[model samples]
Target chain A: MQEELFTSGRNIPNIDPYLDVWHWPIALYLFLGGLAAGILFFAALFYILGKDEVYPGAVKKATVIPPIALSVGLLALIYDLTHPLYAWQLYTTFRIESPMSWGAWVLLIVTPIAFLWTFSYYREAFGGIESKLKLFNKLKFLNTFEAWVIKNRMNMAYALIPLSLILGVYTGILLSAFNARPLWNNAILGPLFLVSGLSTGAAAIIIMSKSMKEKHLFGKIDLGLIIVELALIAHMIMGYYAGSQVQLEAVELLVGGEFTLIFFGVVVLLGLLLPAFLEVGEIMGIKIPVIIPALLVIIGGLVFRFVMVEAGQLTRYLY
Target chain B: MRYAMVIDTKKCVGCSDCVVACQTENNVPEGFCRDWITEVVSGSYPNLELELRSERCNHCEEAPCVRCCPTGASHVVEGGIVLVNASECIGCGACIASCPYDARFQHPDGHVDKCTFCHHRLKKGQLPACVSVCPTKCMYFGDLDDPNSEVSQLLKDRKYKTLAPEAGTKPHVFYLI
Candidate 1:
């Protein structure tokens, strides 16, 4: 509105209507972190419930992904920081109220646990290599901690379940913490992001799952997550439309404004709906290309982050 | 001491002397500013009322930027003046995104920067650069807690409105209509 105001005098004020601080790197980091967390949550949950025996490939792929994705996500975050060299300062001090602090600590804890979980698959490989090479057999290794970790893995799996959930939800809290941005200031964002992350994580697992049953199970799980995400997004938009003046201004960015096309097209349609349709067809015994839907869901997840982060910046209370 | 500013929009003449003087006094980088002015137009056609307002950081009592800063780089110092510690700033842009007034900006040298209410002058027991340089003498600045302070007297003598009170920032700056 200030941009439309007709003032006779020179407008010397620096009227910044929207934020330009965050970019694609932040979105990339959010998606990667959420995806990593989702994978670990599924793997740990199934392992604790004794369901992992039926889907060994899915469990293995899921365990390996969390650490790799988290490492790459952390790199993106560090790259986005203006003072990348001073990143150690984040770990030096902690702020209870800052969501960034929570995120840094959560990632620090989850990364090591996820990496250790992947080592379960390495035992077989190490055994095979030692059998072929007599030198490796003579080179004794410290097995006490590894044996203890293996023996208490079920307890560790239980601990990782909640940490993984926190990792997924913390990424959403990062945006929701900014009360100034109305698009992101909602209670539902935590659940919405959690579901989205899980959906994408399921899709990633589906691509790598060796058994047909495991692939089908993940496909169904992804479908459920997509449905919940759609409902949450609808609620988020409706709540904003019914909110105060500034909130309406924030919603205007999504409804029919600059972000309308991308939000509806990439995020809702291709990302959620089409994938849902394809997955349903697969469940009904109608042959659908597996890679097509999996890649679409992953791409859709990335686009969702891009739209929310970019459009959230465009919605502001001040001009 | 709760230092504050009261700008009288009725007396302002739209001259940008305050802006120039503030840049000079603070050595604000080129393409950046610590203080500036805004022109507001109300009504339509012949009944239009044009008002020139000197605008800067409100130095809010509950600054969202300070609350969101991960490293406490954006902080409130003596006199309740919210200032950024340049050395500690990570330039993560969290403060910039949290400010409802859009008062903060990332400097080219990689730190958040905004109006300090001329804290340097306050140390010398002098008025702020903008308040001192306004040709029309429309801006008033002083310790709001002191009964005899110019800002307190001006606030008591005139009716005023703060920008975006609904924002719940409790801004230290006021506008005398």
Candidate 2:
């Protein structure tokens, strides 16, 4: 065995092996937020480029998910905060350097836009369906608001594109900004999270959409994102491999250490690669059930966040 | 007036006087501490060297904890001492993760807490409780800006090192090995 040293500060909360300051709630929140960002980015991109005509499911129908996802995500975020009552202080001032500050503001802006985008498709999405809830059907202000949103939908698209990109990248940067965790100290995490989010968003559309054409289209899109995700993961691992002693130990935690099985066996193998191959088979007309690959992709996205957040905490500069 | 700390590792016997002294003086809660001892062993089995360090906040000149606080809770005051504004902190733990030294801790009261270098004691021209009670008198505290200060003199005369120097944090705590 190599040289071993021990300490007496075993009762401390977030030191060494006990380092779990951020937990499953933060992981789940990041996953849902990234997924929401992915859905919004694509929904906006398809509309601005006039591809909404060809991909109505991706453009309009998928917009329904973000508002709900964002609300749930925010609840989880609030639940995770130790001093959640003080969270309002995030809005009183703005610091350009703080990623959390950037995230707080971006989420505040995007959640409303996500609702507005979905509402613009109100007549098209929920027109003929009869509802027992007479209150929703009777709101005169809602009808006027919907009309206004429809008219401004194009302008909203311009704002959504950049905001969604920042939201997606912000989830990853939130972790990367913590230079103390050697595993999350890489720059590629931003692009990696963005691509992973898009893949999961595409999967959500494929599962939710009834049209065979929409399912096939998103399958192909997800395949491309999976490729990019794999490349980024490889590049990030290489960067860690080539880094200093601390980084080497950090990578070892993923490669052959405690996280090897869950990160590789579950996230990389089950979450990413398996779903990607299943999608490819679907694209080749192998008649795979639409839900299997798509659901796998979604599960993969959630597990990916768990792996990153947990593993990053296990890594540190000192022993 | 940049305050700095210098602890002579050779003279330290790992007695943990600093830990107990800081706790009582600061009224730190049970199962929590502002500073603790760390024992590091490096090199292979046959050629090993052990070092004991009484570690606490680095009080970095380029503090990431100050930068990452969503609210202006964690800030650097005069003398390059990084401190948390307990009333303002959201206890989001971003500053906790940002620290390379793992110095900051969330108090049971829902705000972050760490070694303040006894800022209150210093205000009365008194030494920090830990430094005052150290049996070996190995711990030194003074303004690094003044060339005549003990911390400045010890750093000049001896070969010393700071923890996690690669972080670019420019830590004020020095270890005279």
Summarize candidate 2's per-residue lDDT along B17-135 as a digit string, tens digits.
89999999999988888888888777877888888888899889999999999988888888888888887888888998998988888888888999999999999999999999999
Give the top-scoring candidate (lDDT). 2
DockQ, model 1, C-alpha based: 0.46
**Candidate 1 colliding pairs:** none
- DockQ of structure 2: 0.64
Segments in model 2 whose C-alpha atoms lie over 4 Å from true places: A1-10, A128-130, B42-48
Model 1: runs farther than 4 Å from truth?
A1-17, A124-145
Give, for candidate 2 chain B, the lowest lDDT window spanning 10 residues: B40-49
The lDDT of each candidate is: 0.81, 0.88
- Give the per-residue Cα lDDT of candidate 2 at A7: 62
Q: Candidates' TM-scores?
A: 0.92, 0.96
Q: Where does candidate 1 chain A have its weakest 10-residue lDDT segment?
A: A5-14
lDDT of 2 by residue, A1-319 (tens): 2343436463676654547789898999999999999899889988999998788888888888999999999989888788888889889888888999999999999999998898788668765552544435787687777778899999999999999999999999999888888999999888888888888898898877778888888888888999899999999999999998888989998999998998888878988899888888887779889788888888988998999999998888775
lDDT of 1: 0.81
lDDT (Cα, tens digit) per residue for candidate 1, span A1-319: 1232313222222235446789888999999988987888888888888887787655665577778888999888888787666677677778878888788888888898888887665454355654676543465553555666677778768888888788889888889888788888887888888889888889888887778888889899999999999999999898898888888988888888988888898889999999999999999999997767888889999888888888888877755
